[model samples]
Target: MTGVPASAAGGTGAKRVPAPKGKLGAAAVNQASLWNIANILTMVRLVLVPAFVVLLFQDGGYDPAWRAWAWAAFAVAMITDVFDGHLARTYNLVTDFGKIADPIADKAIMAAGLISLSVLGDLPWWVTSVILVREIGITLMRFWVIRLAVIPASRGGKAKTLAQGVAVGMYVLALTGPLATLRFWVMALAVVLTVLTGLDYVRDAVVIRRRAIVALRVAEAEAGAVEDSGASGDSASDEAGESAAAESTR
Candidate 1:
C-alpha cells in the first residue's frame, strides 16, 4: 500500500486498466513524434550518404587526401547512428520515422561506400551486389511487419553492421601491408554475417505475424462470448416477468 493506486487499496472490485505492450507499444511508437533529436540525427546520416560518395569518387582516383576525408565522413555518420539510437531509447523518443529512416540510412551508407569501393576496383562487384541484396531485403522485411511488430536490432545484426563499417573503413583508408590483407578477410566475414542476419530477420517476421494473428482472434472470441452471455441474461429476465404477470392475473 506504500505506493499503490487508490483502486487497489480496498478490494472494491474495480478493474484497473493497464497500459498496452507488444504490438500495442509498436502502435504507440508509430504515432509518436518525428521531430525528436534521434530522428534529426538519422536525417543527417541520410544526407551524408551522398556526400560520402562524392568525396570518395573525387579526382577519379584513390588520392590519399580525398580518401582520408571520405573515411572521416563515413565514420561520423556511423557515430551518429550509434548516438541517435541510444538517445532515443534513453529518452523514450522512439518514433516510426526514426524506425524507418534509421535503417534506411544505415543500409544506404553501406551501399554508397561499398559501391564506391567496387567502382574503384578495390573490392569485387559480386561482393557488393550480394551485400546490397541482403541489406535491402532485410530492410524491406522490417517495414513489412513494422506495424505488427517492432523488432529491436539484434546483437548479431549489430555485429554485422560493425563488421561492414570496419571493413569499409579499412578499405577506404587504403591501408598498406598486413592491414590490407586483413581488410579483405573482414569484408568476407561481413558478407557471411549479412546473409545469416537476413535469415534470422525472416524467421522473426514470421513469428511476429503469427502472434499478431493469434492475438486478434482471441480478442474477437472474447467479444463474441460476452455478447452471447448478455443475450442469455436478457432472455431469462423476460421469461421471469411473464411468469409473474400470469400469477397476478390468476
Candidate 2:
C-alpha cells in the first residue's frame, strides 16, 4: 500500500515508541561531564585552598584584615561546597570526578585552615592531628571499599562538616573572650562528631563489603548450577542419539 499500515503506526498490536527528545540530554547530564557545574564548583574550591593560605599569611600572617579576607575566600568555598552537592543530587549530574574531587576539595580547605591555625599557635596541634587522621582515614577507607559499594555521607558527617567549618572560620578570625570560648566548644563538638561518624563509616564499610562478598558467592553458585544443568542435558541428548543409532542398525 502507498500508505503506512494501521498496525504499524496506530494499532492494537505492539507499537514502536518514538524516542523522547530530552532522553539524550538527560543521559548526558546524568553522565556529568568534567565541565559540569558541580565539578567546576569543586575545582573552584580546590583553587581557593592555595589562595586562602596565601591570603591568610599576608601581612606577617596576623593581620586581622588579611585574615578577614581569607575568611571571605573560605566562606565562598564552603558555600559553593553546599550548592555543588545539592545541584549534583537534584539534577542527576553526579559523576566519578565529582565523587572524588568533591571530597578532596572539602578535605583540602579544612585541612589547610586547621593546619594553618595550629602553626600560628591559635589551635592545639592535637586537635589538628586528630581531625586530620580521621579525615584522611575515612577518605582512604572510602576508596578501599568503593569497588564494592559507596558509603554515602551520613547526617552526622554533615553536622561534623558544618561544625568544623564554623569553628575553623571563627579560629580564622581574630576572636576573644566569649566568642573565642564559644568557638572552642564548637570545635569540641566537631571533634566528637568526627570520631563518632568515623566509627559509623567503618561499620558501614564492613557491612557493605560483607554483603558484597556474600552476593558474589551466591552469583557464582547460581552460575555453576546453571552450567551443571546444561551439561547434564547435553549428556542425556548424546545417550539418546546412541540408543537410536543402535536400534537403526538392528
Highest TM-score among the candidates is held by which one?
2
Tell me the tens digit of each residue's lDDT in model 2 across 1-250: 6497777667677576765456456645556477878888999999999999999999878999999999999999999999999878766788888988998899999999999999889999999999999999998998899898989889999999999999999999988899989999999999999999999999999999999999999999999999999999999999999999999999
**In model 2, which residue pairs have backbone atoms overlapping below 3 Å?**
none
Candidates in order: C-alpha RMSD to true structure: 8.7, 4.2
**Which stretches of model 2 miss by more than 4 angstroms?**
1-32
Error of 2 at 18 (Å): 10
RMSD of model 2, in Å?
4.2
Per-residue lDDT for 1-250 in model 1, tens only? 3896656764466676777787556446644767777889999999999899989888884888899999999999999999998878766778777867887898889888988899899999998998899887877887898878877789999999999999999999968999989998999999999889989989999999889989989999999999999999999999999999999999
